[model samples]
Structures are given as C-alpha cells and as structure tokens.
Target chain A: MAIDWGFALRIAGFGLLLVFSILALLIVITRVVTRFASKKGPEEKEKKEERE
Target chain B: MIDYQTGFTGLTYGHIILICVGLIFIYLAITKKWEPYELLPIGVGLILANMPYTGLLLTPEQAGGVPGVAGLLGIFLEFGLYKYTVLPLLIFLGLGAMTDFGPLLASPKGFVLGAAAQMGIFVAFFGALALGFWGIADFGIKEAACIGIIGGADGPTTIFLTAKLAPELMGITAVAAYSYMAMVAIIQPPIVRALISEKERKIYMKPQLRAVSQREKIIFPIAVMLIVILLVPRAAPLVGMFMFGNLLRESGVVDRLSDTAQGALINTITIVLMLCIGASMSAELVMRPETLMVLGLGLVAFAAGTAGGVLLGKLVSRLSKEPFNPILGAAGVSAVPMAARVAQHIGQKANPRNFLLMHAMGPNVAGVIGSAVIAGVFLGILG
Candidate 1:
C-alpha cells in the first residue's frame, strides 16, 4: 500500500493532542474532587486541624 | 532399520542461530540479571521452540491429527496472544492494583510531563513510516504504530497494541520494549544530563507529599475510568481493567481479590505471556532485515521519549513556584520505579540533600495512564 504522508502526520499530531487533552482533563478532575472531598464534614476538618 | 526422525536431522543454520540467541538471553539474565523474570523464560522458550522435532510449536492437526496431546506453547500463543489479548490486559490489571496514586494527586502538573513523554511514540511512528517512504522497509501504518509504542517504555501496552494492530510484529516489539527498559540506566542518564544542567539537577524537592485521604484514593480510579473511557471508548479494555484493579486495592473491602490480582493472578499471566512471547520468535520470523530495522527504530523511539520529557521538565521547573528538578521529567517515560529511581539517583549525585523519588513518581505513574490512552487512540484510528 502507498504511504500517505499527510495522513500519517495527522495521526501523529492529533494522537498526541488527544493524549495530552485527556490527561489534562484528568488532572483538572482530580484537583476538583480532592478539593471537594477535603471540605466535606466538620469531623474531617477537625482531624485535619489536629494533624496540622 | 527403525524409521524415526532424529532432532539433529531437522536442525539447520537458522535454528542453530536462534538457539544461540536464546542462550545469549539466558546468559544475560543469569549473569547480568537483565530482566531475569522475563528474559530467562523467554530464553528457555526460544530454545525449546527451536529444537526441531519437539512438536512444541505444532497444533493438534499438525501433530498428525492427534486428539489427546497438543503443543503447549502453540496453545499459549494462539489463546493468550493472538486469539484474545487477555494476558497483557490482565497484566495491566495487576499493575493497577500495585500502583498508588498519592504522588500524582499531590502534584498534578506531572500529568503534563507524562503526556509529553509520549512524544517519542509519535516520533517513532513517523520514523517507521519514513523508512517505508524511502523504500527502506516494508512497514505499513499498523506496523509503524506498533514500533512507535515501544517509546512508551511499557511492555504490556506494547504487546496489547501490537497484538491488536499487528500480530506479526509482537515478538520483536516486545523484545525491543523489554531490552530498552532494562537499559534505562544506560539510555536515560546521558539524555537527562544533557538536557538539564547540574544546577537544575541539584534542585531539591520536599520528601513529604500531602497526605492523601482514603476517600480521595477511592474516588481517583472511578473518576479516571469514567472520564477516560467516555473520551476514548476504545481504551475501555485496558484503562477499564487497570482502574478496576486499582479500585480493588483502594476500596479496602476486597483484600482477597486485590491480593490475588496483585500476587497469584499477575504472576501466572506473566509466565504464560513471557513464554508465549519467546516462543513466537522462530528463526524465519526474526532473521529478517525488517526485524533489525524495528529494533533500531525502537531505540530512536526510546531516546526521543526521554528527550521530550526532560525538555518539558525544564520548562515546568522554570515556571513553577516550588522548586522542581528537571531530572524528574525523565521518569515520565513510564518505566515505573526504574525511571523514578534513575531520576532520584541523578538528583542525589548532583546534590546529596536532594530527594526527588516521591515527586518523580507523580509523572512516573501518570506516564502509565498517558501511554494507555495513546494506545487506545491508535486502536481507534488504525484498528
């Protein structure tokens, strides 16, 4: 089969973009979830203060 | 006169060469301790399969239509590798069970480093295609993709992708992946030192990461599974199973399942997978110009990946508020503890007070998810 240089370039370019984008989104999600989980209850807040 | 075919009669120059190659693998494993768990079995399997008249590689039909007995290695290759990609995925599940997401949660920018490390995969993908363009090798897009994933510095991801897109290239690619992973100590340091100055390497990171709460730990796998799978549905088989295994570990409720997946389950699958990988390398398949080309391209992929991660690490270090050692970026190539250890070793060499191992692991584990995501992308586009 003949090689399609244009198509191959797209796979390289877009494949990388997609990988970064997805992982970046995971980073955002992780930050949000951790923030929310850290603020859930007074008991947890008291425990955090004690540890600090 | 008795009519019986002796093993010596069937042996030829090609078989002899393969046997020697197997012996070299054994020698490396035993003497050099180079990936002994894998290389040793691979060596034994390669030797066993090449021994002519053993019927180790023959199916029932090939064995004169025998009903009771069949080739053990042949069954493994067909079922474990070719027919179903169960073994590699199960390996991922075990890896997930063994992984801890605390470091990644403590420092999220490592995600960017992890993604950057994957640049080698794409670079090698194009390199393989360029060989075809130059009329140097007969590699298709699928073959190029398989060769490229070796940059991820992951064996199971390489195997899973190759078995899906190009089964013909599995043995060579797996060997290339493992060999480079073993050589991380040699390959990474030079690239890392060249990219980051001694001043940058001496930068210190605090040893204590933010204590991750149990609730956050439980939520990580589920959230990753949902988001990643929704974005790249094709990644479900690998990402799904991997996260499921992590959930088993973190949930703290399924100690039995978690222990089994991490211990007995992964060990059993690894033996079968490694042996099958070794057995697949016959004389004719490996003794080709393309095989050599694939090996060369795999090295290019690995080097390019290390370069990509370190370059990004330099940028992140310059921009971040907290001190960051660029050497930590080398761990983003996803060789797991080995890559992380290399980063820690180099950092300490520059300054005795530096402790980068815990910080380096953030990108190290992130690289695992990064590579698996890219594998899903390739399957979605090319498969």
Candidate 2:
C-alpha cells in the first residue's frame, strides 16, 4: 500500500536540502554583490566628480 | 427544449455571487487600471467558469450533444487541449520569448533571493500537508506540491505545472496564484516593512555597471537550460519551451517567430487558458471546504515566501559592506514587474531617492527560474 518509512525519509531529506541550499545561496549572493559593488567603485567616484 | 429550471440549482446562487466578484475584478482592471492585460480576461473567465448549466463550460455533454446542453468549451477541454497537453507547453514558448534574462544575468546573486522565496514553496508544502493532516485540505502529495507553488506566483509556470501534474486543483491554484500576485502590491508592502528596518529599506543598490553583450544574452538561456536539464529533466517541457522562446528573441534570426510568440501566441493562449481554467470550477468541485483551504493556504504560501525573501535580504544587508535595501527581497516571489513595483513603492516611502525597481527585478525573474527548477526537482523525484 504505502512505503511509509521511505516517504518520510525523502521528505526529511528534502527539508535538509532546502536548509543547506539556502545557506549556500546566501553565501553566493553576498560574494557576487561585493564583487560588483567593488568593481564599480571607481566609476561611481568618477560620476560623482563629474556631477559636482 | 432545455430544462432551464431543472439544470440549475444550488450552483446558480453560488455562481451569481462569484460573478459579482468577477465584476469587482473588472472594476479593478478598468477603472483602477490594475493589471488590465490579464485581470479583465481572468475576471470574465471566472464569471464564465462559474455559470451553471452553461453547456459552453461542460465536458461535451457525454457525446449526447443534446440541443441545449454542455456547450463547446467543455468538450474541447475534455478532448482537445489540456487532455493532450498542448496549450500549456505552447504558452511556455511565448512566455520565454517575452522574457528577457538580462536582469537575471546582470545580477546572478538574485538567484539566491529567488531560491530564498522558494522557501515559501516548501513551507507551503508542509503547511498544505498539515492542512491535510488536519482534514482541512483533501490534498495528497502531487496536489500539495502544485498548490504550494502558488508561492512562486508566476502565472504560466503555475498553470503549466499544475495542468500537467494536477488538473483537478488547477482552478484553486490559478485563482490563488494570480489573485495573490495582483494583491502583492497590497499584501507584501506591510510584510516587507516589518521585516526590514526603514534604514535597510531606504538603502540604494548600485546598478550593475557592465553592459551585457548580445552574444552573452544569446548564450545565457542556453546555459541555464543546460543546468536545469541536468538537475530536472521532467521540467524540460516548460523550461525548454521557455528557453526556446527566449532563444528565438535572442537569436536575431527568428524575428517572425519571436514576434508571433510574444504577441499572437500569448493572446490566444491567454484566452484559451482562462476559459479552460474557469470551466473547471463546477460548483460541487470548487465550493468545498477543501477549496477554501486551498485558497487560504495559497495566501499563506505567498506571504511566507515574501517574508522569507526579505528575511534573507536583511541578512545579506548585514553581511555586505554596501547598503542593500531588504525591501527588494520581497520581490523575489516572481510576479515579475508587479512584485518589483511593490518593492519600489515601499522603498520610496522610506527614502525618496532610492530606485530599486530594476534591482528588484533581478530577484523577481530569478524566482521564476527557481520555481521551475524546484518543480523539476519534485518531478525528478516523484513523477
């Protein structure tokens, strides 16, 4: 009829995946933003100077 | 002759009430100028679907085709389109063509918010399961997954997956998903504010400085498709169709196909889909306590997704040196520009100078792909 134990384990496994993936997701997002923000720093200064 | 009196009963009253609701949607679409492109059609569709004894909405009259019974739309749904799984797939092609992955490519980090928002999907799954365990919702595994995706809040994606995977629940899922997307401009604002301090909401995100090259644009969807395919092949029908549509736009070789997909194809599918979905709402099927539960769960799912994105967003703000407005996080639910607009509106309330609409779109679009990937993952394991 039903594979109760298997189904429970799979749900449990997915829950863990969501948690670990979210942590990994935050790490990746932080790195990318910092990379882009740093890359554009000089250009931002140049624009500010031009405007002033 | 038609037995008009006998054919309609309890459903007649319920449908009349829903028609009034549709009228309100029509008012919102027209006078309020709210999401007119889709709301008007969906409103009329809701009315058409709810009307009882309207043969046009039934399943072809069981081959009797008696003069006064079960008009053409019903028969078509039973045999022609959904049963054959044609329209939903084609609709994905058009959606792909219309979508520009530029925002997503410009800020790959937005995928995290997209992923973050999907926490709503899984959370809603558990919520739906809880509802079932409570005997509040009559959902099993597949139906719960389909319903939970209302958190992803993209219409075609919701329709595509729900149609193929769980047709019976389509009416509730579509109504809840689209309605919530429309109301995101309303529901998400408060949640976003509470989660993010005004200072975080007021923070400005610098625009992506690099110009995305056309060559890269063309290559983008292909790369995404490859990764998604490796992860979840079952989602290929939707993902492949979406990427193919985007490819048509980016390829520069298929202007005609791209134009048709963006314009003619979307219009036709929109009409067919709305009507087909509406037709499924026969009174007995839709008025149950379970249907109400599905609707309630969908709202909770969308709100949870929005909150989850903002929470992660606040975390990102702290972790980064530059100020990142956590309001943009709520846009991670993928109502496209609508979710982003809410972010823009709320961000401006806190700081008039902040312009986060485009920034918000990065995660908004990413949420779309995230949900598709999640759908694929589920399909990979279950179906």
Candidate 3:
C-alpha cells in the first residue's frame, strides 16, 4: 500500500515536471524571438514616429 | 406460448429504460448541438444497444446483459473499441489535424503553463489513490493514473491512455474528460477572474510580425514528433496520430484526406464511441453511489490543477522583469482555446488593454503536448 502511493506521487510529479518545463522553454524562446523581431531598425521606429 | 406480443417495444423495464435513454442521446445530438462530435454516434449506438433482445452487450451465455444474442454494435464495442484501440487513435489524429501548432511553435515558453497545468493530473492521481485507500472504484495504480488524466481535460488523451491501461473505466473516464473540457468555458472563467486583476486582462499583444513559412510549419511537426516519439515510444500512439494529422494538414496535398479525417472519420467514430461509452453506463454498472465519489474527486482534481498552474504563473511573473500575468496559468488544463479564452477574457476584464489569449495559447497548446507527455510518462512508469 505504501509503495503504491509513493509510486503514484512520483509518476505524477514526473509527468507534471516534464510538461511544465517544456512549456516554460517555449515561452522563453517566444520572448527571445519577440525581442529579435522588434529590433528590425531605428528607421522603422522613425517611420512610425512620422505617422504619429 | 406465453401472451407476449413484443415488437420493437422493449420487453422489460431494464430494456425500456436503457432504450429510451439511448434515443434521448440521439435527440440531443440532432437537435441540441450538445457535443455533436460524440453525442450523435453515442446516441445512435445507445439506441441500438438499449433495445430489448438487440443484445448490444455481449456476456457469458448465462450472464444477462441482453439475454441470448449479441447485436452488431456489441461486436464493435468488443473488437473495434476495446480490442483494436482504433477509435481513440483516429479521434486524436483528427484533433491533431484541426489543431494549429503555430502558436505553440512561435512561443515555446507556453509549454510551461501546459506542464504546470498537468500538476492537476498528478493531484488528481493522488486524489484517486487516497480514494482507493478509502475504498473507491476497483482502482489500482494504473487505473488511478488513467482517472487522474481527466484533470488534463483532454478527451483523446484520456481515452487513449485509459482504454489501454484500464478499459473497464473508459466509459467513466472519457465522459468525465469531455464533460470537463466542454464546461471549461463555464468553470474556468471564475477561476481566471479570481486570480488576476482588471489591469492584467487589458494588456495588448503586439501583432505576430514574423511570417511563418509553409515549410517551417510542415517540418516542425515531423521533427517534434520524431524527437518526442523516439524518446518516448509509449507516447507515440497519441502523439503520432496527432502529428500525422498535422502533417496531413500541412502537406497541402491531402486536403481530401484531412477533410475526411477532420469531418467524416471523426464524426463517425465519435458517434460509435459515445454510444459505446453510454452503453457501458448500464443501470447495473453506472447507477451506483461510487459515481458521486468519482465526480467529487474530479472536481477537486480540476480545482487543484487550476491552482497549481496559476501558482506557477505567479512564480514566473515574479521571476521575470517583464510582467507575466499569472492568470494564464488557469488556462493550462488543455481545454484548448476554451481555457485560454477564459484567461484572456478574465485578463481583459481586469485590464481592458491586456491581450492574454496569445500568451495563454502558449500554455493551452503546451497543455495539449503536456497532457500527452504526462500520459506517456505515466504509461512508462507504470509499465
């Protein structure tokens, strides 16, 4: 009985950790990409400045 | 010799009760648009299963599920659903085709929320174990694992895993998974609202500036599937079907097959599976006090899972300089866009400018992959 419960918790924790870490990594990548895409140019910012 | 003038009308109360229940399912599908995906087929199958002397459930000759003979659908329940494990796989393939992994690929960090959301799965599993100790369903480690995935709120994954690990509980587990996913629109809004303030909801997301090429879309699924599937073969049945459907979608050549998989195949399978499920819910089998226990534990599991995801969101927000609205954490239950939308809706209500949907999708889709991985891991650990 003790073994069954411990096994359940371990399996559960492993499942949660595996999925959550991957999701967190996906977010970090998206943030990095967002920063990269936004750095396209001062000129792009200037063009928008003119419009505003 | 007896004065029995029976036609299609059911012969006994057991027969009549189940037959009518089946017909009602059909009516709900045709008229109510109530989970048309599975309800229609289930309704039809249920009607067939319930009819007296139709013998939808096969039993030992002496056992009395349908008296003397087995019906056509009974064979399907036995061979097609139980024996071959064909229907759940097909459903997953269709779900994969319908799903767009673009949002997930674009923002991979969303995977964390997906993972965090699965805390609910483990919580649910532990809950099941406790319930088992307290004398719940004939639930063992594997059975508890199957039941716990319901917190993932992913029907295909739940069914796929459970149908393999604990076929006896498929009826309850599948229905619970779908029911929760469907109600996610209703259940999650309050939870999202409770967690985040108005300012957070109104945050606007800048438009996705980069163009996603067709090649990238096609290659991503194949590569990811290869990486994940090769690593965890147990995950292949669910992941493989999902990826194959996605490949079919992105291939741009198999529109016909994709359409059929997404529409016809899914519809047909859903109908059959739902009926097979409802048929499993016979008065003798389902109408027990333990069902309430199952439902109560399900709610607890969902609530705990939501809390876990949101708490992780809070942690991420605290750790990052850029504010990460923890409301998105509640969206991690893999109810797909529904949970994500709730997070978005709640965020907007708090801060009318905050756009949490795209952010939430990261976790939402992550939740999908997360659920699959968790299922794979569970299957692996148990195996």
Candidate 4:
C-alpha cells in the first residue's frame, strides 16, 4: 500500500496545535487557581513568603 | 533414541549477531550504568530470545491452540504489552507518585517550554514521512508516528505509543528512547551550547519558589485531570492514571499506598516490562536494515527535540521581562531529573554562583505532561 503523505502531515499539524493549546489553557487555569487559593488567607501568604 | 539434536541446531549468523547485540546492552548496563534497570533485563531477554529452539518464547503456531503450554516471555508480551497495555500505564502511576509537581506549580512557564519541546515529535514525523515518500524506508504514518515519539524522551510514552501504532517496532523504539535518556548528559550539552549563548547560560534567576499549600497541591492533580481529559478524552488512560498517582502522593492520607506505588510496585513492573520488551527482540525481528534506520532516525528526533526546546527558551527569554536562562529550555525534553541536571551543569559551568536546578525542574516535570498530551493527540488521531 502507498503511504499517504498528506494525512501524515495533517496529523503532525493538528497534534502540535492541540498540544500547545491545551498546555496553554492549563497554565492559565493553574495560575488562576493558585492565585485564588493564596488570596483566601494571610496565613497562607505568610507561609509562602517564609518558604521562599 | 538417537533423534535428539543439540539446542544450537538451527543457530545462524542472525542469531549470533543478535546475541552480540544483547551482550552489548548488558555491557553498557553493567559497566556504564546506562539505565541498568531497563537495559540489564532487556539484555537478558534478548539473549534468551535469540537462543535457538529454547522454546522460552512461544512461536505463533505454538500459541494458536496451545492450552496451558505457552512461552513465558510470549505470555508476558501478549498480556502485559499487546493485549492489556497494562505495564506502561502502571509505570506512569509510579512516576506520578514519585513526581513532585511543586516546581511546575511555582513556575508555570515550564508548561510552554514543555509544549515547545514536542516539536521534536513532529519534526521526526515529517522526516519519517519524507523518507517513506522518497522510498528511503517503508515508514507509514503509523510507523512514523511511533518513531517520532522517541524524541519525547519519555519511555512509557514511547512504549505506549509504539504499542498502539507499531508493535512491531516496540523493542527498538524502547531501546532507543532509554538509551538517549541515559545519554542526555552527553547528547544535550553541545546542542544546548550551540543554541544558547554564554551570557544566556549565566543569566541568574532568584532561587526562591513560591511554596505550594497542601490544599493547592491536592487540587492540582484534579484540576489537571479535569482540564486535560475534557480537552482530550483519549488521554484518560495515561493522564488519568498519572493524576491519580499524584493525588495519592499529595493527599497525605495514602502514604502507604503512595510509597508502594512509587517503590515496590514500580520496580516490579519495570522488571517485567523491560524483560518482555527484550524478549520480543528476536534476531529475525530486529536484524533488519530498517531497524538500523529507525535507530538513526530516533537520534535525529532526540536532537531535534533538544534544539526545539532550547530555541523556544531563547524566544521566551527574549520576550519576557524577567531574565530567563535559555539553557533551562533543554530540560523540557522529559528525561526526568537527568535532563534538568544537564541544564544545571551547563549553567554552573558558565558561572559558579548560578543555580538552575530548581528552575530547570519546572520544565523538566512539565515535559512529562507535555509528552503525554502529545501521545494523547496521536492516539486520538491515529488509534
């Protein structure tokens, strides 16, 4: 059977674009969650500062 | 009574060559300590598999209608690898238990570097297709996709993808991936140096990372699972198990379970998985010219991955207001701590006071997730 170059190229393009988009979304979500969790109490802020 | 022949009756040049290859793997494992856990067992398996008429591994005819009389290694390959796909996912569980997402949580930019590094996968994919198109090799889309994942520098991911797309090439791909991972210390430096300038390597970031709270730590895995699975439901098997293992570690309530998952469970699974993978490498299977080509293409993929990560690091460093050492970018190839250590070593060589271990780890861990996500993408499209 002959190899389908076009389909393979499409797989590459779509797979990469999907990976980047999902990871980017993850970064955004993580930042938001961490920010909210930190804002809940000054004790948390103090602990974070101490650790740093 | 005199019909008995020696076990070496059917041995040939192919068997000798494969035996020698197995010996080389053993030598590397013992002397150089190159992924000894994997290579040693794999070496032993290869030796056994190549021994003529040992019946250690069942032939297809033997397995077809045999009842309670199957080759030991054949059983492992069929059940552990092809039939159930259990070992790789279990390994991910251990990896998750062993991993601490603290660094990644502290510096989220590592996620971007991690994603960027997966460019190696696509680059190799394209290369394989081009080779196939030109009749240089017979790499179809499935074969090309499996070969490309070796660049991910994640062993379980490589095995998982290969199992799904090209089980025929499993032994070689696993060997290539682990071998490159073992040599990350050597293969990465020159490429990183070529891509990153001396000043960029010496660029110092503060050592302090924000401490993640227990609550956030507990929530991280759940959040990751929800988002990732929602985005690509096909990732559930690998990513879901990984997150579950992390949750066990971070939950603090399941210490015993977490310890076993990371320690005994993982080690046991590693032995079985590596041995079975090795046993699959019979002379007739791996002695082809295509095997050599796959090995060469695997190297190309790895180098491309490192280059991709380093190049992205340079780009991110240029754009961001904060000083970013481009060398940390090389850590995005997901060889776990080794790749990160290479980044740290390169950084320290440039400047004595510079410490990039923790910084590099951000991307190092992120690379793990990135590779899995890419694996999911491939499975989504191809599987």
For candidate 1, the TM-score is 0.95
Runs off by more than 4 Å, candidate 1: A39-52, B60-66
User: In terms of DockQ, which candidate is stronger, 1 or 4?
Assistant: 1
TM-score of 3: 0.83
- Give the whole-model CA lDDT for all candidates, comma-separated: 0.90, 0.74, 0.72, 0.88
The DockQ-derived docking category for candidate 2 is: incorrect
> In model 3, which regions exceed 4 Å deviation?
A1-3, A21-52, B2-33, B43-48, B59-70, B207-210, B321-323
**Is 1 or 4 the stronger prediction by lDDT?**
1
Tens digits of per-residue lDDT for model 1, B1-383: 99999889999888899899899999999999998888998888888888897878775555665775668998788778887889999999999999998899988888999999999998899999989888898899999999999999999999999999999889999999998998999999999988899889889888888878788889999999999999888889889999999999999999999999999999999899998888888887888899999999999998999999999999999999999888988999999888899998999999999888999899999999999999998999998
Q: In candidate 2, which residue ranges exceed 4 Å CA deviation?
A: A1-52, B1-11, B64-70, B79-81, B207-209
CA lDDT of B306 in candidate 1? 91
Ranking according to DockQ, highest score first: 1, 4, 3, 2
lDDT of 1 at A4: 92
Q: After superposition, how far is residue B221 of candidate 3 from its true place, in Å?
A: 0.8
lDDT of 3 by residue, B318-381 (tens): 6766567888788878887788888877777776767777777767877887788888888887
TM-score of chain A of 3: 0.56
Candidate 4 docking classification:
medium
The worst-scoring run of ten residues by lDDT in candidate 3 chain B lies at B59-68
Candidate 4 lDDT tens digits, B31-136: 9998999899999999888998777788434678577667888878888888778999999999999989888888889998988888888888888877887888
Better of 2 and 3 by DockQ: 3
Kindly report which residue pairs in candidate 4 clash with one another.
none
Prediction 3 global C-alpha lDDT: 0.72
